[model samples]
Target: MVMDEKGMVMNANSDNLPKDCPQISETVNLIVHAGQKYATKFNGKMFAFDQQQWNVKPCAKINITFINDDQIRHQFMIHGLPGYLYPDGMVHLELYGEGELKASLIVPSQKKTYLVHCELAQHAEKGMKAQLKVGGGDGDLPNISAISSPIKMDAYSIDWTMLKWGGMVILVVVTLIFVSGRWLLFRHFSRRK
Candidate 1:
């Protein structure tokens, strides 16, 4: 783990190989930007990474540059890796605010899906979520922004009862004001004539 004023990096491996991987297959240079602007495409989301999915060959070494554009803390963490090479099977890169950090990790030779997200409270839930697929991956994770659907989706139900009555009330008030204004103008013009 390496931490400084700019950011923190945990369990980054450049040369080390997982037991299942005899050698690295490929190297991916991934530059990810995290901010509220990225979440504009996802409905009801407040934060997101520029991309929601990444695919790589098994045993691929990913060189990641994580950039946080927001003024708040954000983390880029990948979970469900081989525990031997990565402590608790995770690679974490975090920035306190509006900065960038570079890190690397080698995935094992397994066709599996790994969760990549921000660990800050409600950050992932708010849209800072993504997926890394090794050899096409086992399957997509739930609620990955535009990638997949959520387990239990958020309900945005409208109060039909309020809208119904409120709409009628507004319409009636507007009509009354228009009629009264016309009547006053008619009376004033008659008096002038």
Candidate 2:
């Protein structure tokens, strides 16, 4: 882990290999940007990684350059890795604001999909979620921004009963306003005469 005035990095493994993997199969260089602009193509998202998914062969060592384009903190975290190599089965790289960081990680020789996201409050939910596939991955992760659908969709239901009551109340208010306004006008004209 490396920390400075610029940014912070955690669980960045460059040379260590997962026990299952005998050697590094390939080297993949990735440049991922984080900001709201990346979420423009995704509906109802506030933040996102420039790309939603990355593919690598099993035992491939990925060298990542993470860039945060927004003026707020953002993170690039890959989860569900081998616990021995990555603490809590994760690789985390973060930027405090609009900055960049570089790190590396070696994936195991297993065909699986690992979750990648920012762990900040509502950041992942908002759209900073992605997926890293090793050897094409077993399947897709749910609710990956612009990649897959959520497990349960959010519903913004309009209650017809509430709408009916609100309309009735509005009608009564308008009617009262009209009647009072007419009465006041009639009284003022009668006084003038």
- Evaluate model 1: give its TM-score: 0.79
**Model 1 agreement with the true structure over 104-144: per-residue lDDT tens digits:** 99889999999999989999999999999999999989998
lDDT of each: 0.93, 0.93
Which structure among the candidates has the greatest TM-score? 2
Residue 118 displacement in candidate 1 (angstroms): 0.5
How many angstroms is residue 44 displaced in model 2 relative to the true structure, after the best TM-score fit? 1.0
| RMSD of each candidate relative to the true structure | 9.1, 7.9
Error of 2 at 112 (Å): 0.6
In model 1, which runs have C-alpha deviations exceeding 4 angstroms?
155-193
RMSD of 1: 9.1
- Tens digits of per-residue lDDT, candidate 2, 36-90, equal 9999898889999999999999999999999999999999999999999999999
